[model samples]
Target chain A: MSTSAAERAVNYVILIVFAAFALAPIVTVLAAALSPQSGAESAGLAGLHPGNFVDAWSEGEFSRYLRTSVLVAVTVVSVAVIASILSGFAFGTMRFGGSRVLFYLFLLGIMVPAEAIVVPLFYDLREVGLTNTLWAVALPQIAQSIAFGTYWMRAYFRTSPPSLIEAATLDGASPRRVLWSILVPIGRPAVMTLTVLAFMWTWNEFLIPLVMSPNGDFRTAPLALAIFKGQHVQATALLAAAAVLVALPVVIVYLFAQRHFIRGMLEGAVRE
Target chain B: MRHQRRYLPYLYLTPALLLFGTFLLYPLVRSAQFSLFSWDGLGASEFVGFDNYVELFTDEVLRAAFGHALVLILFFSVLPLGLGLVIAAILNRGQVRGLGLFRTVVFLPQVLAMVVVAVAWRQIYAPNGTLNTALRAVGLDELTRTWLGDYTWTLPAVGMVGTWVQTGLVTVLLLAGMGRVPRDLFEAARLDGAGAVREFFAITLPSVRGEIAVALTLTIVAALKTFDLVYVTTGGGPGNSTTVPAYEVFQRAFREGAVGSAAAIAIALTAIIFVLNVIVNRIAEGREE
Candidate 1:
């Protein structure tokens, strides 16, 4: 694990350069959002200050936007995780007829871009009076997440020991009881990975909310940020503040669950 | 009677199936039917059979939009592959410093909403933006122009945003793959007087062949289905210069109410994405041997 000092220094220089490239715009945003100057011309830490966040929060109604986003993410994650686990356990454990075909059907959610079906889905939702409702967003997202979730959890369940399930069943536990009592705890890593991913994806989703919740009243933070940008085209500071507000939750969530999120995405990428 | 209990699998899968069927599968099927007709998405419509599909190929703007997405693959996939490999090679070096922090900062964009990225980059590319400011500071004042507004630079400018967002992903994936390469192999390579560049090719490159495919699939898909970045940054603007397939689908369907044409383009876009995905998977699998 040894390298010459020159080589080590070279690595650091490379890392620092790419890091600056990656961090520059985001740091500029942070500066712009915090700057006291409205629509600041320069992008630096010179004018950096706070209070724009307060203005953005109140004026942009980000509180409401954040609430709607949280509701959609929580609803989708809860429903998707539970459903995926149940289905995952079934697919992973039981030797059932048509399971492969059915599992492929679930994966169809992952295969098709939401954009492909979104336009038609808008009309379908309208036909059923579900348009602009939270369900419109949560339901489609849940379907999408479960496609990935089941794929993920199924791998975990399929790979994990069968003795635990066998022991639980021999002890007179029902399937639901076994999942809750034994596999759920054992499946913690997979579930954590799935939870972090679902929340991140659902929270950052724009196209669905844009197409489904055309009402602007029921939209996610990203949707809110886009619409806000239209109004504040000239107000760079305010727009930066609004962007920061929209990005804050995901950034914060990622900060906490980074290990699981990164691991899940990388592993999931390999699997795909 | 005992065999009737086999319904448990079906029962367990119902929740996922019901949601997927109602939301994803049904709509996917309906879009195909919708593509054959001219429906404004409100009133009843007469089916115009295959005409929309014909327009998807013939329409010049739609073709360019699709072409722009293909051009984006160079920035999103090819450029990132080269850049990410360099970063990965550096990070994979012995006793690298601040590795965790570097990774977190680099991967920050992936978690961020594209809207946020687009907004931030818009400021960076503005007429009096940071990019221009920096250029002027460096005494390259003549080179400073509104990046997003310049028609020639618009595509590359947007594509660069994609590269920034994706380089981290490719690097991380490559780094993870590199970690699995035996340290002894590198040691032996160095003892044979192989330089870092040689070591990267001799040992690291072959090891991450699978990851390269995965990275290619991920970035290419993002480039092709790129709506949010286009929507926020330029609105496919400075003319039709930056319009991508995903953006066209939105405009044609919702703004112009050319639902059939939009549907046709959407299907075509999906087919491209699917083919790229499968092709990458196949190539990756092929390389495994």
Candidate 2:
């Protein structure tokens, strides 16, 4: 495994090259966002102008959209995590009739793409007078996240120590008590991972918000950003600023929780 | 107490079941049912009986959309895998400094909403955008065009965006997999006078087969579920050159009012995703044995 100096230098060179490739577009957007607003041509790092974000923010009505996105992400993550815990606990620990079938059914949520269900789900939600509302967006995402969440939590719970559960049960604790008081506390990392993932997916979701909010009443940041792009086609800097604004929240969260996010997603790949 | 015990699991499962049934399972079935009819979202419809499914094969645009998805697999899955393997192998071998920083910068794309990605790239590919500007700067004015608007270039342009987003994911996955690979194996290979290429193929490649399969499944699925990018970037435009199955589903269902056709396309897409993942996993598993 020992590397010669020449080979080591080559490795660094290649890694740096790939890193630049990955970063070039983002840096371009960031530089443009900071540059003075102009027409269709990219300003290309002229003078600094921070007002573009303010302009794009108000003009695009991003505060409203971001608030809507936050609302949806929070609603989906909290509910999905709680529900997944219950179902994951049941499937991971207890044996029951149709558990195999039931687990497979949950797996379908992960396997089936959003495109497959979005159309009918749209009509169905509209039937119940739920379309165009934020819940219409949050509800299906909750269901989808729960599907992955249940699968994820089940894996975590399955490997949880049996002795601990037995110890709690022998002391006359109820199953629900055992979970809330014992397992959930010990499952903090798994829960954190799930929370971060659910939040990311919900925040980034485009199809659900687009389909659910035809009237534009409940557009999320990303959805609004898209609509803004069309209208502000001439304002390249303004568009870049809007893009940065939409991306800022996720980027901030990711910087703080990158380890958890990376570990969870990579582990997710391995488990599959 | 015994009764409570018997139903306890079901009770715990109720919330998940309700949401899953209402949103996912039922809609999936309803999509299938809707595919069998000629309903246009606002009408009492007559049964078409597989006419929509037949269109998936016969319709030029729809067929092309699926074909474009297949082409995207090269950029989105295969290219990234190739690049990721090389980058990962190099990083793993060298034990490079600042690995964390590199991973963060690279994986940033995967975290951003595809809408954000599409928007950023939209500027990058504009007529006087970053790409053309750079080309003109380099005195390659003839090479410059409206990349996303050119019929011949649009598909590749959008596909490169996918490549950009997915390469980080593939590299990180392979790096993690290779990290677990025993150093002794590499050392033994080196003792046997194996070159780096020989060592990578003999040791690194075989060991990370599972991770490679997982990477392929995820990226291919992302490629197939590409509505956000196409919608935001080209709007399937200049022509249907960049139209994809997911985008077409939206166009047919919402824009064109061809609900049945959209439903059929969605179902077809879901089946393709499922079958492809299964094949990838089976191949991975077969190789493992």
In order, candidate lDDTs are: 0.86, 0.90
| Model 2 per-residue lDDT tens digits across residues A80-122 | 9999999999999888999999998888678899999999988
> Tens-digit lDDT track for model 2 on B223-280?
9998899999999877888899999999999999899999999999999988987798
Once superposed on the true structure, which residue ranges of model 1 sit more than 4 Å away at CA? A39-48, B1-4
Worst 10 residues of 2 chain B by lDDT: B1-10
lDDT of 1 at A247: 91
lDDT of 1 by residue, B2-113 (tens): 1226888789888877887888888888888888999876678879999988886799998889889988989999999999998898779768867888878888889999
* Pairs in steric clash, model 2: none
Docking quality tier of model 2: medium
Question: Per-residue lDDT tens digits of candidate 1, residues A1-272?
Answer: 67889988888888889999999999999988877655445554555656678778887899999999989999999999998898898888778899888887766567688889898888878888998898988888888888888888888888878787777777778887877888889789889999999999999998999988887768889998998999988888889999998998889989988888788888886654
Error of 2 at B159 (Å): 0.5
Candidate 1 CAPRI assessment class:
medium
Interface RMSD of 1: 1.8
